[model samples]
Target: MRDDGRAILTPPARGIAHILPRDHPQRLVLNDEVHARPSEILEAPLKLSYLAVFAEGEQRADVWRRVQELAGRYGVDPAPDTANHYSANFGPFRIKCERHTEFLRLVFIVEDGRQPESFEEPALQAVPPEWLAALPGQLITAANVLLQHSDGDWPEPERIATQFFDGNALVGASIADGAAFAFTDFRIRADGFSRLLVMDHGMTPRQAGRTVQRLLEIDTYRILALLALPMAHVLAPFLAARERELAEVTRLLVEAKAPDEALLFDRLTRLEAEMESEQSRNHYRFSASVAYEALVDSRITELREERLAGLQTFREFLERRFLPAMETCRSSAASQESLSQRLTRVTQLLSTRVDITREAQTQDVLASMDRRAKLQLRLQETVEGLSIAAITYYIVGLVGYLAKGGSRAGLPIEVDLVMAASIPFVLVLTALALRHHRRKAARES
Candidate 1:
């Protein structure tokens, strides 16, 4: 039965392989992603120092060049410019460097058998001081971690925490189901460096390396996430003022007449511009903070932490201390978005009011023009009536004089009777002639 099952699966697998005509361009890269940053093999009693720098543009190139310069001292070729991660040994100490989207992380490790009386002896002490000082970009985080074997001659967590962390309340946990125990007070000492102490209970070299890496990462990401807190604090009063200004603008828009609308619109435009600028300036920081917070939580979960007596666990400390600051950032971002949306609506309303006022004014001007045109038409009609009457009177007088002259020449007619009788006729004829002339003129025009 097993043979038959294998045979059936094999045929389909072969058929499926032939089905793809060509390989995808990114197939290899995608497949290799899981193995990108393989865990290092680390024995116990090691000291590691880590640094993260926020970098951009020429600063990034500067960091790459600086690494190359350091590599030359050890006779090793530099990592390629496109490489996101690199690791190499330089006789005295080994370094692992990784490039992130907005920052670069450098880890210096001193392997086992280099035990000092104090864990405060930093692993970074082995690197060239001048070279370390010359690193590019502003420092985002710095920490030293000491990993020790826990089989024998190990002090209690209390004594270790007191000696290394200056008696601060320690957060300790047994992670990986008791494979290792971790302790940190999460405080920066007077030396300006934080400490993490990892006790290898029974973890193999690979597990130990990963464990140490996770511990360091937790600290790194925690600080990064809190970077948004200060930005939120600064923006709080600013946002409140903006909100009040927006409310005032809205009220003005409601009470606004036509002239006031222009001013209201301008105010709305300026407010919107300010909000957009704020969003543009702080968008990346807020988003990056959220991403870093998620990483912190993920690393904490991977620790699979169980609490120790008289101490808080990693999860407990983060939940109590870190989550509230993230919430503040989120609330501030929401408020900004809401304010912007309200401003947009108010601007639209004000614009509509302005358009309606313009339309009303246009209608009034048209009505006034209609009344003037009517008055002009009435004046033209009166002048035409006077012209008709004057032209008729002159023609009638001329006809009366011609009639008198004709009678005196040779006719048995009385001039008085003729003139008197012809008066009505002349009036009628003059009117007809004037009417005909006016009709002809109208046709021609």
Candidate 2:
């Protein structure tokens, strides 16, 4: 038997052969995930006080501790740390606690509501005020729900509204395919709590529970979804300022000189940094809002809502009021993303232009260096020719002096012929040695 009261059927072989493969590490946990937060069986004439609080990260540990302490007071074992849902009957009232990704939801249910009107007494009255006060997190959404029995018909819309919602216009529906009728003005009254009334027609306890969960969830997700609206409003002007600046920067890029291009690129880089920072700050918020809105839509669909007479349905009400704000948020997110991409594109284009200008300057400098090298080579060749002539002239003079001396000594030598012949040899040897030295140096370099 399961905790949900369903019978577990046994297979023919209670234990499979030992040859079977081992199960995945997370198989059992994953299999039980779908049943993590099963709806509580609820009956008519009940009052519920629901709270959705903005508590995330370290705050969640505090929340779990508070719930644990409260459970201990009632002699009930708290759920394990790995669990995200907890429910317990604490004698006076039943409490359900769920830890969501960014929020904590707690609902107190009491089956002893005797109020002729719904808001006269809420289920939270049964909770200890001190414990309630000590509960961590900022309250983001709070509502009181009255589940009362109905025969085949319900009271008139005007009467119901006047009695419970202080004459506000009502938004309601024949929900659960006519299994129940639900009504609310979606107004936070003087008590700082919105209201909902569900009149069960032929619903079993489980159906009643599912209906209440849906209603509560619709309220929760919708409010969380609207959390991004203010951010969108704040971002509107910021985005406009950035957009104008981006346009100016882009305009400057068109005709910027080399130095100016670098300056503009610097500015673009700064703008990109600012955009990325803004994205990091608001990306999670806007995306979470979108997801919450989708969940809101899904819950509304599960209600199978049909309009009641002389009132707007929940879907209609949300479309008229809530969805426009959502659209505003969506538009803001899109605009920011678009602006960021444009900023990146412009920055990249400017960077390319700057790089190209610097590269062209480098090429021009290299070309000038090449011209200088050519001139230096020509001068070096002329210097080599002069050096060879100077060496040959000196050597030939020395030989001529020796030959003249030899001729005076009566040797049969011709001074003029000897000197002339020696000129070509000296010139050839000097040129060849210079060429060899140049080739060796070039190879080493």
Candidate 3:
């Protein structure tokens, strides 16, 4: 026994083994010895699930009836509907059914229960002999039927169909594809011991159920990514086109072209509104992730790169081709409007432009004159200070000479008093002359 209390065995069949004590809540044990020799151990306890594929539009009733007959022979049930359509025992077996536009799927599971405490027990001795002999034939029969059904002539596109059966119930899958339809089938033995086959199909209710939880997880992410592509590619282009049209209309308005302006504006607004509504609807959102994953696969990566390159090319085309076209349209519209408008209106527009230019020139002239006046005032102040200094110097020298001569001739006058009196008079005359010079310079400049 393994540490987990499950009995392990390498049976007579190569690569096939039996795992007992399979009822544990935390672990699933498989019969691996049978897996090694797939052909010799057909009746071994199935450790893995099987998948069957069918072409789409194959008569649903016929397919169900055939499967029903097979299930009845094996003492299993055929659960049929628009969604799930296969059944298996809840004890130690797995079964599943799914349908797509071009294919159908059927899978089977086998369970090996916990080992008996002693091999001497009658139940323990009888268990292996009873189950193993019957299992292989049943699996083979079911697979053959599904294969035959797939081979039948049908109007749908030709497809390849295959099924997988594992000696151990842990891993198996099936695939079906036709020209118009494709789908995959998978089976898992739960880690927690349970006797249920999780059947999943592309219906809303199945998506919410436990059986399909993992498949749904993968599909959902892919769908989201795929949905974003059209937004960037298809819808973006439409929006850009509308934007260009609006830009043209605005350019025309700026040029005072009124003809058809209201109509163009109305059309552009309506297009924008339609684009918004389509975006809100987002019909492709669910499938986007799947598309993106499909692109990510090794075989499709080049195609995805090409699609992205195409998108870039389309963007360039819109900028280079459509934008220039819109500009031309605006130019033509403006020319036409100029011809249609009354002469008085055209003349008024021209007159408005001329008036604006003239007003700007007048402001420039007034500013220039103000600057020149300020400069003249500053020059006059500077010249007045220089003139005062020069006049004072001359007057002081004259007073000094007179004082010296008067002193020598015995005149009753102090040199300092004479110089002080002359200073004020000299300053006053200098100020007057500086003011007159500034006036003259201002008039000339």
State which candidate has the highest TM-score. Answer: 2
For candidate 3, the lDDT comes to 0.40
Instruction: Return the top candidate by lDDT.
Output: 2
> Per-residue lDDT for 1-445 in model 2, tens only?
9999999987557466455788889999999989988888998878999999889888998998998999998888986887899999998999999989999889999986453355788999998899989988888889999998885766589988788888889999998988899999888877788999999888999999988999999999998999999999999999999999999998887778887986897888889999999999999999999999999999999999987778899999999999999999999999999999999899889878978998999999999999999999999999988988888889889989999999999999999998998889888998899899999999999
Q: Total clashing residue pairs per candidate?
A: 0, 0, 32
Task: For residues 1-445, write the lDDT of model 3, one tens digit per residue.
Answer: 9999999975576434354434655333245423321111112212333333323344544555555655565677555544334455534344454543333444443435432121122211222344323322111111110111122233121112122222222211221112111122222223211121122122223222222223222322233343344444454455456456555644654664334444544554564456446545543442333443443332222111112111222123334533443344334333333322332343354446556657887999999999999999789678767767987798778878988899889988787888888888877877788778868988999
Question: What are the runs in model 1 whose C-alpha is more than 4 Å off?
Answer: 1-19, 112-117, 152-155, 376-445
Candidate 2 clash pair list: none
lDDT of each residue in 127-211, candidate 1, tens digit only: 9999988987988778888887786543477787678777777888889888888988888767667888888888999999888
TM-score of each: 0.82, 0.93, 0.25
What's the candidate order when arranged by decreasing lDDT? 2, 1, 3
